[model samples]
Target chain A: MAEKKVIHFKIKRQNGPTGAPYWEEFKMDYAPNHNVVSALMYLREHPVNVDGKKIEPVVWDSNCMEEVCGACSMIINDVPRQACAALIDDLEQPIVLEPLTKFPLIRDLMVDRQKMFDALLKIKAWVPMDGSWDIHRHAPLIAAGEQSVRYLFSRCMTCGCCMEACPQFHQDSAFIGPAPLGQVKMHNSHPTGKYANEDRLHAIMGDGGLTDCGNAQNCVKVCPKDIPLTDAIAQLGRQTTMQWLRDMFVK
Target chain B: MADAAVDPNALGERYHFLIRRLHSLSGIVPVGVFLCVHMSVNASVLAGPARFQFAVDQIHKLANLGILKPVEVLFIFLPIAFHAYVGAWIWLTGKPEIMRYPHLDNIRYAVQRWTGIIAIVFILAHLWHVHWIIPGGTEFDAHAAAESAVNAMASLWVGPVYALGVLCAVFHFANGIWTFLITWGVTIGPGSQRRSGWVCGIIGVVLALMGLAALAKFKSMDVSALQHPPVTATGKVEPGAQTTGH
Candidate 1:
């Protein structure tokens, strides 16, 4: 039988967020369904390049070994995707791997996505559970339609894909980005979450809040969960109008 | 003492001030609100010639009133001009890399700003042709004004330009509405914000299509019987044209 095919990989390596980045190449025996994460594992076992010299084991991050966790996110062939799902056979020769550029580099393919999380906090993207325990005990059940809308919003993994794709989200920006806004909508719809609704609304009302979104719909397009971002925005418009009127009269 | 405190990053503070001011002003009333009104007014075209003409006449009368002109100059023209000016300043000062990449944020911002410029041009030309150029002539007559509007609508140059202007205006307005909601804290959470996004997107497309349809099917008017008789300083028509007046 002829010699089995081999897979070649080129990865951009960074020591830390402020450290210099460099490229490293490796060749491994091809397996029909081998993925980038598996290849990296293989490299960990036998750390050597095509030139036949031993080297340091490659560094990267992974938790779920599945796309759901979003911990394995990296730029493969210049496209941001989870390494666990990127099949080596499907990728072009010399499969390139790099860290997600939208976040601060931790090391190698690892990045700090804390900014996205911080945005979630800034938007107060949570429903208050207070009074809900008593209310739900006596309340009428949710309708199928309401459940479906809630279900759509429940899919957000805080994966930062929407933030990564957003033009308005950047290092310099205080703009909370799209994912957090979706969270705000989800929480506000909750019976308990509605209590803090005014506070949430007030937070986003500032200059760097929702006003920064340019509505290119790029976040929606890139969202893996198919979240209805633009719809939320429109509803928020009417809600804010009502809120504004209510605030004027009440306070 | 609190008010007298100076920020070490004075440049940043200054930049923030300008940005916040522009951002706040841009959100006020929003372009979408104006587009909604414009579309509503234009939809009157479907009510047949007399009603549409009467509506137009009423608008002209209201606009020409001596007291409202300065208010119009201040509120309508000044806000738009200032918005454009500050937008340009922001664009120029922004990182050049942003211009090169044309990311979604940059594209949306650029498109909105450029469309404002386009709208300004369209508004000026529209005002010149319909209000000043057509109405200022000795041949100025209602029939002639109606004919000019129809002619402008039918022209190869004007037809496409108007259609494009309507599209741009609607898109700009809808996008602005979406952004305005965010600015005002309506879509603060991740879930609701995302949901609001879809709503804005759908409305933007729908409103744009509606405006486009109105412009495309606008009915042309007959102007052969147009006659102009002299009027007094108080704008009262002479006896010969008194029957056609008002």
Candidate 2:
């Protein structure tokens, strides 16, 4: 008879935003091709600790089982990444899961990434063009190379991985983090969006804006979409300088 | 939405924005540029004390620059005072995770902040010894100035202190150049940053070497003659034994 193999998990569980955090260890029957999300789902069904006590099922947030949605972001094995993409087979035994530290924790492994969204609003991370009426264009001539670069910036899923790793993104500080800054680069690059470039630049020129970034460059390394965050920041830095000079001259 | 978008007052005063920009600009143009010239000029000591004194005299005797006092005050001292003030605020507030993060850029950021602090202390001490406490006062001749610098570096502790100061200042300036580019949007992408990294690294190494060489030159010279007649500005000749020999 073959021996039963089991997966071990050490999850940090919290009841609510202000709840005290505690750890619970679980052992589950080893399943083939199980990722963190699947393993978590199995734990939800079992809800038994390593001591064999039935407990409340662990809760987390996820929309897509794939890595695209960016909703299942958590600290797995001390790295901030999407739980959907973390393979149980690849991770070390006694795998650890924690909520993203930069955001407010909802429960167990779920975090509220509202700060990142709010920053997007602050930076106006969208093109000004509204679909009030359909306008025809002869050709929206964009070079392939330019499209490729734009595509890179557009892939940002607001995962908050960059924010989680950033040193400047703290509770007491007003830094808008790297995600929205990249969004600035994304929209600012668009042919139509360039019309609102001044507004975007001004948005980041104030408190907790571009100047707050300490140039740690941690955002680029942790980004799942491989967004060029540092590049965006540098570009924004230049844009803000130009904006400041222009403001001095004009206003 | 129009009010929210258009109202610049939502952020802070326009002066805060301008001051922040000035802080970055001040570091690069007047302060950084002046440090480069100052270090290169100090490197003249490698040719011998005569050459060093000659170089110092040329700077001291600039004709068009109203007086050395005004030029030093406006260009060098004022910028440094402002940079130090703003830099101190930044250094205090910055929370570094180099130990936990340990990423390459994280380490660089930590070191840059730390070096900025050390460089501030170094600059203060250098000014006190070189500019403030001259034996014949601030208007001392180039020879007297060179003699005082040599006398100061003659000590074991002071030599290493000046060396460390120079190294820290050079590192700060070099690393600062890289950040300045990124902050100012001059190096907008990773490729450009990588290239600029190489250039900044070379500049740092060269400047550090020049500074160290200047110190070594001071260390090697026999200034027993200058030490004997080391007269204070108040016409008091200091004890000869301290400066006479190594």
Candidate 3:
């Protein structure tokens, strides 16, 4: 018989958020079209180690299985990216999987992305369109030029890749990271969203806000959505400066 | 919604905006502007002892007019203190993962922080060495200036160290001008940022060249010719002021 083609994975396993982490190796029968998530699923069924011994199934998070929902994000071969999009064949042997170091790890490859969501909340990363009923005939028109830029930012999936690569967005740091800043730029461009612009700007102007961005710009490089995060940072920098001036002179 | 996101009147909230903006403002005005001016002032050495001492006399004359003291404190000293204190705090808190992110921008980020550290130390040491450390070796006295300059070249590797420090300081100031513009939102889009990068790059190169040229001028001077003191504004060296250290 021809030698059986195999795929190897070296997953960093943990029992809990505070659990001690250790690497466990497993090999699965090679199959075409297997992504990291599906490979983990195959291993989930087998639960067998490389030593031919029964073990616990590997744990990870996934929703869309496509790249859109970013729950399957993890460190694959030292790069933080979406596991669902990381095709096993394209990756090197014994593909390494670990939780993103910048976040609070849950178990295996899962990490709590609450900090990113909290940042979004802090920045009021929304259009205040849901308040008291004042129904209008038409939605506010946004310029095509502005929409193209806003469209780029609107693709953020709340994945931690940007934060993972950010030098200022670690667990102990107060910097809100770049993801929220992208949302800030996106929402602020909306004709309705601009009403709360100063409020959004005010939220980011504080300690953990926009100024905390170190301009390392790894966030832009690592963003899965290809968001123009640094541009948003620069835009926010400008907005806040204007706000600062306005605060000094007008209000 | 969510109670207006963040509190507007909190201690940190109220001041962080102003403080951060001021931080960038100080970098441009007092800090960046001062670096350029200091380099120009130091470049006077290229004109030889007479012109260099003339420049020194003009600066000291500002003290006689009582303008230099206040200007130094407000523009130079105080801004430096604030910029350094705040800058050090920011630098310390950063989570440096330089090895992973090897992008040019990321490296520039780390370089900026490091150059700030080098610049602060260099400025302090340079100030003390020229202004306060050596007796009668004030930069005003051309002979003492020459003695100290040669001593710096030979003693404990001051010349190379000073040169490195000045280079780092120049890098910090020049690179800082780019960040300053961004932080202030002066460069909004990629086009503007690219243009700003070129502008700041030219500024940095010019500043570094001016500083190095001044150092080169110091190294080129004939040590024996600077043995005698030049006549000053009062036509007298201050009492207890020896012309040379040894």
Candidate 4:
């Protein structure tokens, strides 16, 4: 008879927002084709520790159990990504999971990712439109290259991987992180969004805006979506320069 | 939103747009440009003291050797003061998490800030010894400068200090340039950045080598006949070679 293979799991757990964090380990009979999401589900059902003590079920956030929803993001083996994508077979032994350190902790592996969303507000990541619209003959002609670029930026799910990996971004730091910067480029290049171009540029021109980026280039590397965040930063850098010129001459 | 953007009484936020850009611009124009020229001029030491002193005299005649000169005051001193001020604020606040990320650029992110700190210290010390902490005349002759520079480099620690200082300054300038492009939006994409990276790398290596060579030659020179200079607004251009390198 073959020995029963067991999967070892070490998880960082917190009870509530004000709960003290502590470590809990669990062992499960080896299950084939289990990603982190499924494995976590199994653990939550069992809720038993390695020491044979009954414990509270491990809690996390997830939606669209594929990688698209950007939820189920946690530090697995020190890398932040969607838990649904972290396959058990590929991950190293004793898979460790922790909450992202860059945001406010809500539970064991969930966080208040509201900061990233708030950053979206800062960049005004939407096109302006009035209710009373006159009919136009055609839609705006976007170049194929520009469409491809915008598609890449549009795929950003606000996963907080970029934030988790960014040195300049954390709970306290004012750097608006790379996700919003990419959105700014996307929206600013947008024909309809171009009306708010100067407004968007002015928003980021302040203290915690573009200049705060230390240019670690880590945000691009750690982005699971592979968005060109640094490009956005550089583009905004140029846009703001133009804005400065306009402020000097036109304004 | 437009009305809310610019507040007259908002502390610090009001000029952040101009101040931040100025910080990036200041690092490049006068300060980064000066490091390049200074390194090359100092490297003339390899051609022997006569050539080295002539390079020094050319600069002294034009820019002068004084704690307070118009060209030096406006261009060199003011820019450096502002850069250091803003740079210090940036360095103190920005924390580097290289352990978690550990990417090459992440490591460089830390190195850039560090070299800034080192370069500033080195600049002040170097200026104190040779360039401008004390009052000196505009017409500091070739022999006098060669003598002063030789004796300055005569110390046991000066060579190593200069070697470290030169490398740090060059790295700071080159890296500053890379970020400056991104900061000012010159190289927007990764392909553009990679190409600029190659150019900046070459500039850094060449500048660093020039600075190191200058240090090596200056340290190996004969400083036995270090003499006081003759004070005059109209000093002789040539007064025989005062020193030679090993």
Interface RMSD of each: 7.4, 2.4, 2.1, 1.9
- 3 versus 4: better TM-score goes to: 4
Please provide, for model 4 over B122-190, each residue's C-alpha lDDT reduced to its tens digit, 9 standing for 90 to 100: 887777656644434122334566666766777787888888888999999998898899899999999
Which lDDT tens digits does candidate 1 get at residues A1-251? 99878999998988778989999889888878899999899999999977889988878888877677777777787556678888888899899988877788888888888887777776677765544345445543667888799788888777777676666676766567788888878888877778778767656655555545555556676666788775666566556556656766987
Residue B26, model 2: Cα distance from true site in angstroms? 1.6
Task: Identify the superior model by TM-score, candidate 2 or candidate 3.
Answer: 3
TM-score of chain B of 3: 0.82
Q: What's the lDDT of the predicted structure labeled candidate 1? A: 0.65
- DockQ in order: 0.11, 0.48, 0.57, 0.61
Tens digits of lDDT, candidate 1, B83-161 = 6666555444322223334566547666876776687677666656555433642332344333444545655666777
TM-score of chain B of each: 0.67, 0.82, 0.82, 0.84
lDDT of 2 by residue, B196-219 (tens): 999999999999999998888778
Model 3 chain A: worst 10 consecutive residues (lDDT sum): A128-137
Clashing pairs in 3: A238-B185
Backbone Cα, N, C clashes tallied per candidate: 40, 0, 1, 0
DockQ of 3: 0.57
Worst 10 residues of 3 chain B by lDDT: B237-246
- Top candidate on DockQ is 4
Poorly placed runs, candidate 2 (over 4 Å): A1-4, A134-139, B1-7, B10-13, B62-66, B133-141, B225-246
True lDDT of residue B214, candidate 3: 81
* Residue A15 in candidate 2, Cα distance off native in Å: 3.0
User: Which regions of candidate 4 deviate over 4 angstroms?
Assistant: A132-136, B1-9, B62-68, B131-143, B225-245
